[model samples]
Target chain A: MKKTNAGKKYAIFFCQQIDKNQDVNRRSIEKEFGPQIRFFPIPCSGRIEPLHLMRAIESGADKVYVVTCPEGACRYREGNIRARKRLLYTQNLIEEIGLERGMLELIRLKAGNNYTVDKLTRELLG
Target chain B: MAHKYHILTSPTPARFKPITKAGIIAWEEGCLKCARCVKKDCVYKVYEKRSLDSRQMLDSLDTACMDCFRCVQNCPNRLIQKSINPLYKALGDNYWTPEIIENIWNQAENGRVPVSGGGYHGPFSGPGFDAMWTDMSEIVRPTRDGIHGREYISTTVDLGRKLMSLEFDSGGKLISSPPPLVEIPLPVIFDVLPWSPGGKGINLAFLEAARNTRTFAVIHQADFMTDMDEYVPNIILFADDDVLKLSKEMIRRLKIIELPDSGNVMAIQEHLKKINPALVIFIRFRLSRNASVRAAALAKEGAEVIHLTANENGMGKAEDPLFIKDRIRQIHSHLIEAGLRDEVTLIGSGGVAMAEHVAKLVICGADAVAVDIPLLVAMECRVCRRCTEGISCPVDLENIDYAWGASRIRNLISGWHNQLLEVMGAMGIREIRRMRGEMGRAMFFEELEKEIFSGMGIKGLINGK
Candidate 1:
């Protein structure tokens, strides 16, 4: 739902759920980079299959990352935890298959934390 | 010089109803002397007061069924129409469905094959042999020289394992597994009938015809793999046995041995490797979406001969024939893409109807083909929908002359061969074998209909695409 900017490398920030904040994220991200980070919001990060992430890379994505809630804080409760496992499994598969594993990353943020977003963004962009 | 008319013609093979016309039988016990039965009750008006002869009743049964049931409906004491015909057994059989029987009857009547001048008219495509059609865009161009300059293309094919080369060792005599190949002058080959019309004469006729044409007839392994299998080395007998059991002294005389679908072609290749590795092991696989994959795998596994077939009627799936051909082409292209196209031989069958069909199939990438029902059709058949109704056969197969049938079949194959040449010449290709899978020499009807026809000829097909 949200559009991001091109201040940095092409990266996907997959959100756990799409909401009014998606517009907020799109505006702020675009305001920063115009059209760089492409945010794909799903119903829950748990629904993302590893194959989907692999396919995204195969189709020319430089990097992909999932944004879930901080531990034990997601409204869907166990969904964020599932997303972490899926992400880890996918990263391992890519490593075993001799692809760049660092390209696939996961970052967690509390429900109402702007400071965490900036910090995570700083880490991902770095 | 002349034209033909279509009257009461069917789109598929014409078959006859298994039941012959009804015969009049007199019940001596119930006749009040039946004066009314002779006067107005006979539908065919064949009833007369004369002494009834059982032989005459049988001879006159010729599909003239009144079915009024007048005698049954009007019998004051209920008598007549109770003729017990032994031939009633002719109607029901696995292959000879009531519909198949009717098609045979139509063929029997004219002593000629039934045909539809129009395009196909069935429900959906069928399984196996009924799903494909050969592409024929190059059909009309005449590059061959005949009387003035029309060339004649031959439909003959060889049925033996081909080899890259052979070598010897040990005492330096030779350690070669020279595969036996059969060379037929025509592309048509006799196949095991869909129905087992277990008549020695019919099989003999088929064999005799194939022999005469320098081609081979295929009999199921079930036929001669037993007691009566002493000789007849010219006939290609297909069996499911391991090649080790097939080591007979007359190995050189065998034309071909169609391998059964055992999923393990390696054992077959290994067995043949003992004798002549070139012993053609024709792998018969049915047509399907995965046929290309299957074909590619077979070629990879060292299959000598690969056969892709639909069903008896030329279809084996519920998809379009073009779609099926595409599937086969993909497999062929996959082999080529994988740089293994020359390793195995390809044969396709089913849904190959016209002479143009042969060339088209070759273009789709088959070295040769195996035809089924069209053989019977060319010998005279209509695909009627009746064979199992406890009735009699309208067509008297017992009385057909085999020689006449063979000539008609020969004419048909010969006609097709010339057409193949016609298409090949149009594309400026001299050798047909080289034209296999050459898409550059063809135009899919759909493609042409879409791109070129949007502005050009033919009033009906313009879709403004």
Candidate 2:
């Protein structure tokens, strides 16, 4: 899958299991990245499959992102692990199929991470 | 029994926290005696068991309610009015709140690890980490024991270097240093997640799990500054700073400290010089090629460990899944070339998503791996991706059932542990430590690329990795 134009190229941030507690960080992410990016919260990252990633690419997403909790910090513990393997497989598939692999990315941001959202956004937009 | 926490404590830094004193209580006047109250069996128990009058409930919800919506979910009559507690909102400057953590806790509890057959309701992949996926097609066979195990399967990994060359005295007696570091029983730890569960219940689960398994966990200093400080046997705290902002005694209790790899090695050296603690100093760096060079330098300069990662879900760095492993291998090989390979501990996080992947990573040269998204997935997270968009996340963790959440996590670990043992059995390795940084045993995509790069380009492309 390829991401071409910056306009039609929609980027999204998918978060799973966020609630009132995460609002603090969610607000922080929102405050830093206005409405340019869309957010999708899931029950857990493990529930995400390669099909979902591919569908996202097929669904007009210039780029798709998964903002999971820090490594080993998933509520289910393996949600992030399962999601990562799926992503890794997709990446390898991208290489094998001769497609651009930069279209999909997964990140493990925690509730209290001190990293700036702007830096994250910069990398995402690029 | 010197805990890892003892070696990594630093004074807590200043942080913004939101709180509210409003009571979600109800006084006398209106009484329908609704048998099913939302808070009746709510895990957080923000409400009293006694029947509340209308005025009392209205006057009280402002503060007592955490906005968890437990009452909202269980209210039969839907009589309770609820809203976000503003006071709690003020605690976080951006997104650090007890509520967010609670939500995650809820997700980990249920909806995930369904009993094998279930329904998945969500978007394919909308945004953020949802876009990333891990590969797992190796295991075609299935047995309840996880990896064809009849007995026990272990997941412990050695945390230090192996002898590049042991020196011998003139008498021919081999001389050995203290082996450099320790070993944990598990391949990974809960580590410090961006979010955490509330109360001592969940914390106890992690500690008990670690202790039972003889594994390590990275926790906040506040989790055990004193009361639980006694249980600091296997924790690695983030405190690789000067004199530790915490008290000296607390610092003394720590064994390993995780500091950011700001590329400033001197600061680490300087800190070490002051505290002079025997505990190892671990530098946390981004999962970039540049950081590998820094790791090499640190290893050469006597650093004990290097923690590298690609965000939480192991995304970014190289977008190609095959390339991601290649990058790790490159870093591992670079360190080997630097002659400090065996001396530095390499802990990798991000993209480490499966049992086979764990083995593959170890073969690629990581002492241990960390995970983020899997935990969420195990907790029943459906990567709707609309999370960052439109505010989605179905089970809505804000009002989670703590006990249920803990059980769900336990189930997930059980599932993964079974898989780990299977890989170990297939590799024919009895001890997990033997598997660390052993690249010779497994396979990589590049080698496969070389093996069948031409004759079947298209077919090879599909089955590449």
Which CAPRI quality tier does the interface of model 2 achieve? incorrect
**Could you tell me how far off, in angstroms, the CA of residue B163 lies in candidate 2 after the best superposition?**
4.6
> What TM-score, over all chains together, does every model reach?
0.50, 0.49
- Model 2 lDDT per residue over B1-465, tens place: 222211111122111111232323221113355644533645555555333222111222243455566665666555454433333343322222333333333333432222323475445532222332323334553332334445444566666545667888999988765443666666776665544333454455455545544566666655654545655766677654443566655556666666766656647645653664455566776666466677787777666777777654454356434234555777888988878787778887775544445666776778787665455443434332324454433334434443444455554555456556656666566556677766676654444446776545575466555
Q: How much RMSD separates candidate 1 from the native structure?
A: 28.4
lDDT of 2 at A21: 42
Given the true complex, what DockQ would model 2 score?
0.02
Q: What DockQ, between 0 and 1, does each candidate earn? A: 0.00, 0.02
What clash count does candidate 2 reach? 110
Interface RMSD of each: 38.2, 14.5
Please state the i-RMS of candidate 1: 38.2
- Which stretches of candidate 2 lie above 4 Å from their native place? A1-126, B1-154, B161-163, B167-176, B195-205, B220-230, B240-243, B263-277, B316-324, B376-406, B437-453, B456-465
For candidate 1, chain B by itself scores a TM value of 0.61
Shift of residue B207 alpha carbon in model 2, Å: 3.7
Ten residues in sequence with the least summed lDDT for candidate 1 chain A: A16-25
